[model samples]
Target: MEHQTIKRIAAFSDGGQGGNPAGVLIAETLPGEAEMQRIAAEVGYSETAFLAPHEDGWRVRYFAPEIEVPFCGHATIAAGAALAEQFGGGRYRLYLNNGDISVEGEIQQSLAAASLQSPPTRSEPVPEALLAEALALFGWHESDLDTRLPPAMAYGGASHLILPVRHRATLKAMQYDQAQGKALMEAHGITTFCLVHAESPTRFHARNPFAIGGVYEDPATGAAAAALGGYLRDRQWPHHGEVEIIQGEDMGARSLLRIQISDQPGGSIRVSGTARTIS
Candidate 1:
C-alpha cells in the first residue's frame, strides 16, 4: 500500500487554542480496513477520518484506535477543513457506512469554520439495568442526574449514553476506570458517555468519555453534541432553536460546540465548529 500523508487538525477549537485533535487523510483510494485502523492507532488521536472520491461525492470512514465508528463529528470537521484547503470552501457530501451526510467548510484566516449535518437523531429512556451500571461507573446516584434531562440513550450517527447532571461541579469532577468503562460501553454498544450540565436553556457544559474508542476523553465531541440537541428537542427543552456547549474545560482543552436544532423531531441537527491545523 502506498503511504498516505496525514493532516492533523484540532476541531471545535476555542479561538484557535483548544480542541480535539483528529487525523485526516485524503487519498486517491480508501485504504483497507486493517490499514486504516493501524493508521488511526499510530496517529493516536481520538479519531481519524479517511476520504476518497466516490461515484457521486466522497466516501468517508472514521476510525478510532480500537474500532471503526459509523460516523465521527470532530474527524468529519477536520476532514472538511482539509477538503476546503485542497478543493476550495464548499459543502461536501459524504457517504458513511450506514448513511449519507454533508459537511460545509470554509477558510477563515488562520482557522477553518466547519459545520456538519448529522444523521437523524433519536433518544430513548435508558434501560434500568444499564443505567445502574453507568451510575456505578461514575459513582453517581440517580439524584445526581438532572431531573429535567433524564438518562437516555441518544444517537446521532453513533450511540451515546446521555447523563445530564444537575450541577456543573459534577461535570468538573468526572472520572471512571477506563477498563471498566470500555467493557460496559462495548457490551451495551455505547460509543461514549455524554456527561453534561445545563447552564441555561441555551447553554451547556459537557464531558464525553470515549473509553470504547480507547480514549479517556474527547475535548470536543460533535456527534454527542448533535445527539444532545436531538434529545433536548425530543424532551421539548427550552433551547429556543440553538444551544452552545462548552466542553473540555475541566480537561484544559476548553473546546466549544454549537448545535442547531430544527422544529421537526428526530430531524438532522447541525453541529458547527472551528478547526485549526496542528503545527
Candidate 2:
C-alpha cells in the first residue's frame, strides 16, 4: 500500500465555526478497498472520500471508520471543495457504488462552497416496530414526536430514519449510548438517525446519531438534510421549493445546510454548504 495524502476539510461550516470534518483523497488510481478502509479508520473522521479520475468524471467511494457506505453527502461536498482548490471551481461528476451524482464548487465570499445534486430521493413509512425501537433507543415516547412531520425512512443517496420532535428542547436533549445505537441502527439497516425540529415550513434544526458508522453524532449531515428535503417534497409540505437546516448546535459546531427540492416526484434534491480546510 502506497502513501495517500489525506486532505482534511470541514463541511457545512458556519462562518468557520462549526462543521463536520471529512477526509478527502484524490488519486490517479484508487487503492484497494482494504487500503481505503484502513486509511479511513486511521483518519478517524465519520467518513472519508476516495476519488480517482474516470472517463468523463471521477470514481468515488466513501468509507467510515468501520465500513464503506454507498454515498455520503458531506464528504462529497468536501470533495468538491478539494477539487476546486486543486483544479479550479467547476462541476464534477461523481460515480458512487449505488448511483451517479454531481457537485459544483465555487468561491463564495472568499470561502470554498459546494453544492451536491443528490440521487433520486424517496421515502416510506417506518414500520411501527422499527419506530418503537428507535424511540426506545432515544428514550422518547410517541408524545415527543411531531405530528406534522411524522416518522419515516428517507433516502437521497443513502437511507436515514427521520424522526421529527415536537419541541426544540426535545431536539437538544438527544442522547444515546453509542454501542446500543450502533446495534439498533445496524439492525434497522439505517446509516444515521435523523432527529429534527421544525422552526418553520422552510427552516429546521437537526441532530444526527451516526453510531452505525462508529460515530457518536454528525455535526452536519448533508445526506440526512437531502433526505429530509425529499420527505418534505414527498409529503407536499409547503417548502416553497427550498429549506434551510441548522445542525450541530448542541455539539458546539453549529453547521448550516441549504436544500433545494425539485417539483417532480422522486426527483433529485440539491444540498449545499460552505467548507473550509482544517489547519
Candidate 3:
C-alpha cells in the first residue's frame, strides 16, 4: 500500500540547537510495524511519532530507531506543532499504545508554543542490582549520587531510571558504551537513563542516555522531565512546587523544560517549552 510521507520537523528549540528531536509522520493509514521501524530508523531521531486518522482524533505511536516506545513527549509536542501548523492551532487528542493523552498547540502572533499532558505517573524503587549495573555502565561511584532523591524507576508514559547526581560536573562527565548500554536498557525495559543534578531549589541540569533509541544522548527529554516532576511530587521534595530543567548543554545543544506540580492528588502536571522548526 502506498502512503504519503508527511513533513517531519524537529521541535522544542531555537534553530534546533536544543530540545529533543523527533520525527513527525502523518498519514491517512498507519504503516505496518516493519515499515514504520524502517522509516523511524531512516529518520534517525531519538524518537519518531506516527499519526493516523482515528474516529474523532488520531492514533499515535512512537518508535525509537530500534524499538517502539509506549509514548514519547518530545515527539508528541513536535507532532502537535506540525499538525497545528498544517491544520491551524488547536488541541489534538492522541490515542497511544499505553493510554490517551492530549497536546494543545497555540500560535500567539508569530510565536508558537505547545504543551503536552502526559499519562498518569508512578515511580518504583530502583533495585540495588539494577542501580549498581547502571552506575558501573556510566563509571559512576555511589558518592556521585544525590542521596535525597534516591534512585527510582519512574514512569509517566515510558519507563526511565532516574539517577540524580550530586554535582553538575559528574553529570557532565557521563559516558558509556552505546552497544552495551542499549543491550542493558532493552533487557530491562528502560527507555532512557535520566541523569540529573540539582543546581538550585528550582533549577536543575539533566542528561538522558538514549542508547536504546540509537542516540548517544538526548538534548532534552520531555517524558523523562515529566517523570522527574512526578517523582519529586511523590517524594514531596523541598521545592516551591515547580522546577526548570536545562539539558544538552554538555553536548552544546542547550535545551530547556519547565515542570509544574499541583497539590491535588493524581493531578496532571504541566510540561511546557518553546519549539523551533529545524529544516
Candidate 4:
C-alpha cells in the first residue's frame, strides 16, 4: 500500500504558538465523502481541508471530526500555506460549497502568511430571546456587554453570533457546557459564538465557542474575524479601515488575525494571518 500524508498546519499562530491546528490534504482528486469523513476523524483537528483541482482552481471542503462544515477560515489559511509550500507562494482560487474565494500566500522571513478574501458578509440583529440564552450560557448579563457593539448574527464565510463584552477579563473567563452549547448552537443555526473584548478602535480580543462542530473552543477563527469586520463596516464603526484581533490568549495559544474591510456594502472582507507547520 502506498503511504498517504496529511499535513498538519497551525493557522493564525502567534509565531510558533497560539494557532488552530488544521489537517490539509492536497490530492489529485478528492475521495468520496465517507472517505473524507474518515480521514477527518482520523486527523482529529477542529477542521480538515480537502483540496482537489477543479474548474478554474481547487475544490475545497472542510470537515470536523464529527461533521462537515460549509466553510472554515483557519483551515483555508493552512491550505493556502500548504499550497504555497508545494507550488510556490502566489494567489489561488478556492471553490467552496457556497462561493468562490481566493487566498494569497507567501513566505515572509520564517513564517508563512496567507490572506483570504471571504464571501460577501452581512449581519442581522440577534433575537432578544436567543441573546438571553447565550448570555445565560456564558453566565454573562446584559450589563456585561459592550454597549457600543450590539449582539448580532454575522456571516462571512460562515454564520456566527457576535457578542462584545465590556472587559478582557470577562472574555478570558469564557466557559460553557459543551453539550449544552452544542445544542444551543445547532438549534439556533449558529456555527460559533464570537465573544469579544474591544481593546481599541483597531484592536480586539476574541474567543469562539464552536460547539456546533464538537469543539469546546477555537484558538483562532478567521471566519469569525471576517464576519466581525463586516459587522463593523455595516454599523459604520470607527474601524479606520482595519482591525486586528488577538485570540487564544486565555487558552495560552495566543493566535493573531487581521481583518480589512472594503467600503462597499456586503463586500468580501480580507482575513490575514500567519501559519506554521506543526511537527
Candidate 2 lDDT over residue span 36-83, tens digit each: 999999999999999999989999999999999988989999999999
Highest lDDT against the true fold, candidate: 1
TM-score of 3: 0.94
Cα-based lDDT at residue 278, candidate 4: 87
Q: Which segments of candidate 1 are over 4 A away from where they belong?
A: 1-4
Query: Would you estimate the TM-scores of all the predictions?
Result: 0.98, 0.98, 0.94, 0.97
All-Cα superposition RMSD per candidate: 1.0, 1.2, 1.9, 1.2
User: Which of the predicted structures, 3 or 4, would earn the higher lDDT when compared with the native?
Assistant: 4
Off by over 4 Å in 3: 1-4, 14-16, 108-111
lDDT for model 1, please. 0.95
Which of 2 and 4 is ahead in lDDT?
2
Clashing pairs in 1: none
Assess each prediction's global lDDT (C-alpha) against the native: 0.95, 0.93, 0.84, 0.92
TM-score of 4: 0.97
**Order of quality (lDDT):** 1, 2, 4, 3
